[model samples]
Target: MAGVIQEFKEFAVKGNVVDMAIGIIIGASFTTIVKSLVDDIFMPIVGLLTGGVDFTDFFITLKGAGEYPTLAAARAAGAVTINLGLFINACIAFLIVAWIMFMVVKAMNRLQRKAEAGTADVPPPRQEVLLEEIRDALVRNSTRP
Candidate 1:
């Protein structure tokens, strides 16, 4: 138990674990922002482009209640619905988020490559004095023989 606790403590103190935790927290927050951007900004524009059809309210009730027309009504009456519009909205949001992440990662990779190329520290070629002396001795021996 003590060994396990000590190992956990060491792992927690490591920079990589802390960095990963921070990244996860930031990613969760970023996801909220992305969701808002999609729902508030993009969805409205899309709705306008598609002649003001609201995607959130669009649903096909499997069991039709003739008097209750709205999706909320069908949902309230325990009617099963295929929410295709909401699914489309979700897919669009997912694609947008995926594109944004791709751009961010692409830029990061570009910068990383540039930084690595700029600061490359290849060791200088090696030369051994003893090896040179050995070569010279061989040459001398060959000439004598």
Candidate 2:
């Protein structure tokens, strides 16, 4: 139990875990912003483009009263719905967030590689300079004799 507790403490204290937690919190907040962007801005424009058809109301209730009318109506009546349009909305938001995060991670990796490459020291190749000089001297002496 003590070993487990110590391990947990070590894991929690690691920079990577802390960074991941911070990232998750930021991601959750970012997700809310993205959701609002999709639901409010994008959907309204899309609705106007598509003859004022509200996609959020598009659903197929499995067990409920006649039609259930809208998403709010279905939920208010406690009806189970497929809500495929809402799923599409969620997918759009997820894709947008994922693409943004990919760009960020790619830029970070490129910078990290650049920083590491700049700091790394590459050694020059070695050669027998002293031995070559000694050998040349010995060869000249033997030739003179």
Candidate 3:
């Protein structure tokens, strides 16, 4: 039991675990922000361009007899509907998030490459230099004998 508990503690405290937890929390928050941007900001502009269509209220009633002006009306009247507009909105939000993540990963990769390039030109350690010199001396002495 103690070994299990210790192992759990170690796993919980690992940098990767902590980082993943933070990433999940931040991702949730980012999703909320992106949803708002899609529903509130982008949708409004799109609606204007398309002559004031409300995407959230757009739906096709599959069953029940009567016209529903909006999704809420359809729900209130107990009409089954296929909310294609809502699905479109969700797709747009997903694309926005994907694009932003792609840009972020690209930037990170570029920075990492620059860091690697900077480190590549560094000289070898003094220990390695001394070891190589010793090896060369031994080789020279062996050849003379």
lDDT to native, each model:
0.85, 0.90, 0.95
List the lowest-lDDT window of 10 residues for candidate 2. Answer: 121-130
Candidate 2: tens digits of C-alpha lDDT, residues 15-133: 99999999999989999999999999998898899999888998999988777878999999999899988998999898989999999999999999998888786543356777778
Better of 1 and 2 by TM-score: 2
lDDT of 1 at 66: 64
Query: Which of the two, 1 or 2, has more lDDT?
Result: 2
lDDT of 3 by residue, 41-129 (tens): 99999999999998998888899679988898898889999999999999999999999999999999999999999999989999999
Residue pairs clashing, model 3? none
TM-score of each: 0.74, 0.75, 0.83
List, in order, the clash count of every candidate structure.
0, 0, 0
Best by lDDT: 3
Can you tell me which runs of candidate 1 are displaced by over 4 Å? Answer: 121-145
Residue 30 local lDDT, model 1: 84
Candidate 1 per-residue lDDT, tens place, 23-118, comes to: 999988988888888889998998999999888878887776564566788788888889887897788878988998999999999999998987
